[model samples]
Target: MKLVIGGAYQGKRAYAEGHDSIQKWANGETCPEEEIFSCEGMVDFHLYLRRLLQEGKEQYVREQLIPKLLQENPGIVLVTNELGYGIVPIDPFDRSWRELTGRICTELAEHADEVTRVVCGIPVVLK
Candidate 1:
């Protein structure tokens, strides 16, 4: 249900997006055009997502996004990159976002029934 997806966008992004699309397909709905969540790099996107998660806004995210997702499909596949695996960023704010997202993903992974790691084009199961 949760995965720490990592790879160059060309490779792994498709997997995450495709999986989400398939869920829509099964529900008799057309999948929307894929948005590249990793531009400015996956790390940046994830960091922004993490801040949203950690701030008091998490409840809003969950209330608005999670429940609707569960209602639409039996399974919810969260696609996120494994940002903690890389070198520390030079920018202080970038560094903070990395740490925040890394922690958020880690916690989610633990609660998830399964956790997967994607590297280059390879996937390794960690849980």
Candidate 2:
């Protein structure tokens, strides 16, 4: 799998699109949980996580969804916002979401064949 990450509006989606056609989920778009494994690529995955969190499926996302997606689709490209930097959120759930996103990114980065960070529209390959 390939992982693309950066701050919000940093052009991560644009960069990923330059490489392949991607199915995007953003701003609370409904994620078809059963169909994600068949996707070739996905963008704004953080929003999907947020949805899962809203649905009280955060544990399932952390423990099962991502692993199953990767196992089922070996070459999928994933684009997510980097949410761990800057001031910490005051809301407990916000803080937890940031931490969760970071941990997920770290895990994905470790297993990804390539990892890229986009900053100000420029993509820097990290691994």
Candidate 3:
């Protein structure tokens, strides 16, 4: 598996696209929740995580969904925003989301075959 992270609109999707021929691309903000599992990989996974949190499904995501996806698709690539670099959010939920996202990213990075951080459309490999 591969993980790509960067700030919002930093061309993370473009970079991922350049690296692989993604057949399943789902937008976290708009894709139907049921359809998310059918996707081979995820772009803007932070947004999807937020959606899960909003729906009180975070536990399911952390315990079931992510593991299931990774097990089913070992080559899946996840693209997410690097949420820790900006000013901390004022809302408690936002703060929790940021923290959880960081933990998730850290875990993914540890297991990923490749980890990349994109800045200004340039990718820097970290693992």
Candidate 4:
């Protein structure tokens, strides 16, 4: 399975629509944060989403989820926000997460049979 995980809004939304639950093995509660979470900021869907895609989370997804997906599924096109491409996040955990998610996404895209970015609902193939 090939996935394009990012930190953006619409990208995850599209992926969310296809899956019944966002917390499922693929993108849903695929993996819980290993530590206790203290609600910060507004804790709205988006901010918490940013926290969900926080860097360390991807490692869990990669290890625990991706393999199972490949085993039971023939192919998958996963999407996530591109968080780290912009300015540095103020929070230490946030910054670390940005780098981690970015790196994982890059690896996923590289090994993907195809890779794309949707701008205004149009996908531009990157590789």
Q: How high is the CA lDDT of each candidate model?
A: 0.50, 0.81, 0.86, 0.48
Per-residue lDDT, model 1, residue 88, is: 90
lDDT tens readout by residue for model 3, 1-127? 8899999999999999988898888887778876555776688888888988999987886777767766776777889999999999999999989998998888888888999999999999999
User: How do the residues 29-83 of candidate 1 rate in per-residue lDDT, one tens digit apiece?
Assistant: 1222122221211223363465564455555544553344334432445556666
- Clashing residue pairs in candidate 2 (N, C-alpha, C atoms within 3 angstroms): none
lDDT of 1 at 18: 48
The lDDT leader among the candidates is 3
Off by over 4 Å in 4: 5-7, 11-26, 29-74
TM-score of 3: 0.90
The window of 10 residues in a row where model 3 has the poorest summed lDDT is 33-42
Estimate the TM-score for candidate 2. 0.88
The TM-scores of all predictions, comma-separated, are 0.55, 0.88, 0.90, 0.54
User: Which regions of candidate 2 deviate over 4 angstroms?
Assistant: 21-28
lDDT of 4 by residue, 1-127 (tens): 4343444554545643443233323332333443112111011122323555654455565465334434544254455666756889788877866666566566556666666565655456677
For model 1, the superposed segments whose C-alpha errors exceed 4 Å read 17-21, 24-74
Number of backbone collisions per candidate: 0, 0, 0, 14
Better of 2 and 4 by lDDT: 2
lDDT of 1: 0.50
lDDT of 2 by residue, 1-127 (tens): 9999999999988888887656543322565766467777777777777767877988797898768877898788888988888899999988888888888889888999999999999989999
lDDT of 4 at 124: 60
